[model samples]
Target chain A: MEILVAAILTIITAATPLLFAALGELVTEKSGVLNLGVEGMMVMGAIVGFAAVHYSGSATVAIFASMLAGASMAAIFGVLVLVFHASQVPTGLALTIFGIGLSALVGQSMIGVAYDGIPQLHIPVISDIPVIGEIFFSQDGLVYLSIFMVFAVMWFMNKTRAGLILRAVGDSHDAAHAMGYSVLKIRFLAVLFGGAMAGVGGAYLSLAYSPLWVEQMTAGRGWIALALVVFASWKVRRVLLGAYLFGGISILQLHAQALGIAVPSQVMSMLPYLATILVLVIISRDRSKIKLNAPASLGKPFHASR
Target chain B: MLPRLIKRQSPSKAMVYLSPILALLLTLLASIVLFLIMGVSPSGALHAFFVEPISSIYGLTELMVKATPLILIGVALSLGFRAGVWNIGAEGQLILGGLFGGATALFFYEKTGFYIIPLILIMGALGGIIWAGIVAFLKTRFNANEILTSLMLSYVAALLLNLLIHGPLKDPDGFNFPESRLFSDSALLPILYDGTRLHLGAVIALFFVGIGWILLSRTLLGYQIKVMGDAPAAGEHAGFSHSKIIWTTLLISGGAAGLAGAIEVSGPIGQLLPNISPGYGFAAIIVAYVGRLHPLGVLFAALLLALSYLGGETAQMKLNLPVAVTGVFQGLLLFFLLACDVLIQYKIRTSKKSESTIAPAVKSSIKSTSEVK
Candidate 1:
């Protein structure tokens, strides 16, 4: 029972970052933009968050700083893809490449540096219960925030007028334009939100999860988040479930390594990635399911014509 | 008074070729600023980066040695990109090729045979084909996105490389190093230059570029690839199988990437290390885009990018700049190029009046292209 609780806790920690990133990307894609720079944004957030925490000695300051850093990175992507009419696929890749270089250069001194993990929310009386209390009441505020975002995003997408407008823009930019919607403006904001979310997800890695700075620390979680959005078929609720599923696979490998299994560590490391490929194959096998929910203008560049 | 982007009725042919040069110039300007910001003398740093790397014949040979894998991978990726197949697993395929190529070398450990080099090269390409084959199969059979599958497979490939080196191919005489035993003389690529690392692989890469150019510009297969990319429905109307194009391009690109990997290990490094690649596969994507997805353009882009690798090393040695600058430069170049591509389809104008006239013309052109299907 103790082992089970511990494993579940680790899975929550692992899944929270993906959830944040995928949710942000989900909003962006729903607005008809595909920002592949999530990995880049996440790594930048991780490094900047680590640096801000080290210097300011405040987790709140660090979180905001990381969000700003991520937003700035997304802004670069937006200007190119949205304003300049660049190809989304290559532009997103460029953003990632630039982010990686910039992050590594900036965090040169902070490599291998460690800090205290983010403080958990300690709710009085609620913390005294069994496994449920430890899992639900004791997690860091950001974990709860990640979960809260799922509900918030779901509510916003289905219940709000703005959400419908965003979806309409994604469905057909020309039709949406005829209806008086600004596709570029909507997509630009969505991209920024996605960037900020990816940044916070990255921050969770550096400030809360491992509480240290390392180059490429996000280590393909950004890419996994990208896959998660696709595997979820752009559904907010499915993004949450997919994040936990991937998180579970990741922690399972860690546990296997700790158990002194006969398998090599590298072999164990292949589990999450292989599982990603496997899950992608399974999810994509149903063409109708993907086509049903996928944003029509997901990757197409919108050229506004008066 | 506001600048409205006026759509071009047809894409500017001049911009298609000219934008890369414009991007390269912009990157230079950006790099100069970057170096100045780093507090290094811009001229000295630039010279150290661009001129010093190939000032000597020996340096020129090393340039080709470095450009070998890039050109090979770039040309293959160009083929796939043109055909609308995003095979992002070239890095993984390269690693797998090295593993199999190195395995062949180790199998003939201490035996010298004239057939060894060709055998290793063939096996290396076959390894890449098999790895990329998984991506192709999943894409065809399961309708999976090759982008995600291939990328995920890359991480799996990296882990597999570590597993192979640490356990299955660990050098016996070496003090527990996670690497394979050195290849025999016959297993190694024949040297093409004296006092340099230039080998048979460099020649092969150049040859592949020529072959790629001819195949792309003058063949029925090339026409099918172009059709498949621009209009898939037209490809179907023309009775060309969509799955066939995917498998063919993937196998070709995967095969080429594998050849480059085997060559890197056999030519320069001379043995399989725990990690043989320094992200050559990913860098080749930059090369493909910079080259405008043309085989000949890839040749030039490969040389320039290879020079950046040399420049980064020189910068670290002389200017005390971080080697990460190479990646930054490549990223910036791609960004600038993408931004410049806007000029190909649109022009900035001060009047909304011109946009009114051009917008419908551009829209009609777009419609007409689709009408070809």
Candidate 2:
């Protein structure tokens, strides 16, 4: 039972980043712009967040620094895809490559650097609870923020008037354009929002998760976040579930190895990736489900020339 | 008001040729700023980056050595990209090809036969196809997106390579290191020049480029690919098979990438390591785009990009600049190129009288909520 609780805690730490990133991307896609630069933005956020904390030693400033770095990366992507009307897929790929390279260069000085992690909340009564307190109340500020954002985004995307405008733009840009909506403006803002979320998620890696700087430290978590957005079928609630599910799978592998499973460690590392393929295939099989939810203008470049 | 962009009746030929040059010049300017930030003399840094790499004959040979794999992969990927098939799994395929080729050499350890090298190359090419075949099959049968599947498979391939190198393929007497024994002379590719690593692979890459130019410009399969990419429904209606194009392009790209991998191990590397081909696969994607997805263009682009690899090393050693500069340059160059390509389609007209044109968009936004109501 203790093992299960520990595993769950590890899973939350693992999943929170994915949830933050996926939630941001979900909102972006809902607005009809497909930004494939989540991975790139996340890495930039990670490096910037680390450098900020290393210099400033303030957690609040670090988180904000990550968001700005991610936003700047997205702004580059925006210039290419939005203003210049470049193909979204190629532009996003370029952004990611650029991000990875930029991070490597920027974080060169921070290599082998370590830091004190972000602090966990210490509420009075909630801190005294038995299993629940250990599981939830005493978690870091970012974990709570991530959970709050999930619900907040759910509310914003579903109940708010501005959220409808974003969704309408994504569903059909032409129709949205016909009605006089600035498709590019809405999509650009959505992209920025997505980038900021990805930034926070990336900052979590350096500030909370590993508590150190490393080259390409986000690894393939950014890609996994992208997959999570799809696996959830672009639904906010489902995205939360998908992130945890993947996080669970990831920690489960680590636990299996620790418990003396005979599988080679390299092979064990492949479980999450293989499972991603499996989940993707399963999700993609239901074409209608994907079709019903995926924004019609998700990846298509909105020319606005018409 | 923003300058009104008007669509050209036809793509500007001048922009098509001029954009790459502009992107390169812009990249040079960006490099200057990057250098200034690092407290280095921009001119000296530029000299080290662009001029120092190919100033030596040996450096030139190394440039060709790097260009060989890139050109081979780029030429092959161009065909697939043009046909609307995303085969990002070239890296994985290359690894498999290298693994197959390396395993073959090890299988015939100490064996001497002329047929052995040719056999290994063919097996490597075959290995690439079989690896890519999984993506083609999945996309055709299950309607899966090749982009995601191919990427996932690449990770799997890397792990598979790690597993083998650490276990079965570990050098027998090398203290449990995760690498294979060096290839016998019979297994290695013949050298092209004395005192240089340049080998038969460069020549083979050139031959593939020539073949690619011919296939793209003078074949029915090439026409079918273009038609399908531009209008899939129309191509389907006209009896062109979508599945056939997908399989064909994926196989060709996979085979080419595989051949590049085979050549790398047999020619320059001459043995398998845990990680082979430092992202020649991803780099080739940029090569294809920067080349405008043309075979001849990819050849020149590959050489230029290969120069960046050498220049990066030069900069790192001479000025203490990080080698990550190459990746930054690559990404930046592609961004500028993509942005510059916009000039081909739209003529930027700075008209003072553009206010009338911009009025409708402002008015229509206020009307959007009504339709929803």
Candidate 3:
């Protein structure tokens, strides 16, 4: 029972960053922009957040700083893709490359600096319950925020009029433009929001999940989060499901050793990536489904008739 | 007034060539500001970053050595990018190639033969193909997204390289080091330059560039690739098989990346280690773009980017700057390249009246293209 709870906590810790990134990207894609720089943005956020905490000794400052760092990175991407009408795919790739490098340069001194992990949330009465309270209520503030975001995003994407407009822009930017909605404005904001979310996700890594700075430490989690968005088929609920599922798979490397599994650690580490490919293959095999759900203008450059 | 983009009657053919040059200039300008912000003297930093590295004859040869893999990979990636098949896993493919080629060298373990080097090179490419083949199969058969699959496989490939280095490939004579034994001279690539580290891979890279140029400019497959990228439906209607293009481009890229990996181990490093490349695969994407996705362009771009690698090392030693600055420069260059590419499609005008005059002409052209589609 103790082991299960411990594993569950590990899963939550692992899942939070992916959740934050994928959720942000989901909204961005819903608004008809494909920002492949999630990894870059997240890494930038990780360093900036780590540095913010190191200097300020405050989690709030760290989180906000990371968001600004990520949003700034996204703004570069936004200008290139939205304003200059550059190809979204390569521009996003460039953004990722730029973000990773900038983050490394910024975090040069912060390497090896450690911090006490972010404090967990506590409520007076609900926290006293056994396994349920421990599992549900004992997570850090960001974890709760992630859960709230899942619902908030679901509500925003589904029930809101703005969400409908965002979807319409994604489905047909020309139609949305004809309707007098600003496609670039919506996409640019969506991209910035995505960057901020990716930033918070990075903050979760440095501030909560290992609480230290490392170059390229986000590793391929940014890429995995990207795959998760595709696996979710742009649905918010599925994004939560996919993030946790990937998170669980990611923790398998740790648990495998504890369970005395004979596999090499390197091989164990390959599972999440390999599983990403497998899940992508499974989810993407249904072409009609993807075509039905994917935003019509997802990655296409929007050239407004001025 | 904010300058408005006036759509060109047609894409500027000259701007296609000019954009990369403009981008390079802009990157240099940005680097000056970056160095200033970092509290380093911009002139000294730029000198150390670019000019100092290639000042000597040996440094020039070393630049070629670094560029060989980039040229090989960049050429292949350019081809793939033209076809809209994003194979971003060249890093994994390169690693697998090294592993395969290195394993072959290990298998022979001191055998002397003229054929050994060629065999090792073939095995290297085969290794890359086998890795990228997984991506191709998943993409073609399962309808999986190539971008994510290829990238995911790269991580898997890296771990696979680590696992091998720690286990089966570990040198028996060395003290538990996570690396393979030094390859025999017979397994190594022949040196091209008499006094420097320049190897046969540089020549091979040049040879492939020529072939890539010829294939791209002079073949039906090239035309098919262009049509497929520009309009997939049109390509299909023209009876070009989409799957075939995907397979051809991927295999070509995978093979090229693998060959580069093999050459690295055989030519300069002469042994296998956990990290054989400094993100050469990823960097080649920038090379392909900045080179304008043309074979001849990729060759020059590869050399320029290769200088960045050397400059990073020099800057680390001289300016006390972090080596991450190289990556920052590469990324910035690509960003500037993409931004500059805007000139190819549109003309910028500051005059407010120009928008009204140009809008109708551009709208009609846009409508015609949509109608054709």
**Angstrom error at residue A106, model 3:** 0.7
What's every prediction's RMSD, in angstroms? 5.0, 4.4, 4.4
Q: What would the per-residue lDDT of candidate 1 be over residues A76-168, giving only the tens digit for each residue?
A: 999999889998887888888888888988898898777988899888889868898999899998999999999999998999999998888
Per-residue lDDT for B139-201 in model 3, tens only?
999999999999999999999999999999999988999999999889888887798999999
Best by lDDT: 3
Candidate 2 docking category?
A: medium
Q: Please, what is the whole-model Cα lDDT of each candidate in the order they appear?
A: 0.90, 0.88, 0.93
Candidate 1 to truth, TM: 0.96
Q: How well is candidate 1 docked (DockQ)?
A: 0.81
RMSD after Cα superposition, model 2:
4.4
True-vs-predicted CA distance for residue B316, candidate 2, Å = 1.3
Could you tally the backbone clashes for each prediction? Answer: 0, 3, 0
Off by over 4 Å in 3: A124-128, B352-373
User: Model 2, residue B19: displacement in angstroms?
Assistant: 1.3
Q: How do the candidates rank by DockQ, highest first?
A: 3, 1, 2
What fraction of correct interface contacts does each candidate retain? 0.80, 0.60, 0.88
Better of 1 and 3 by DockQ: 3
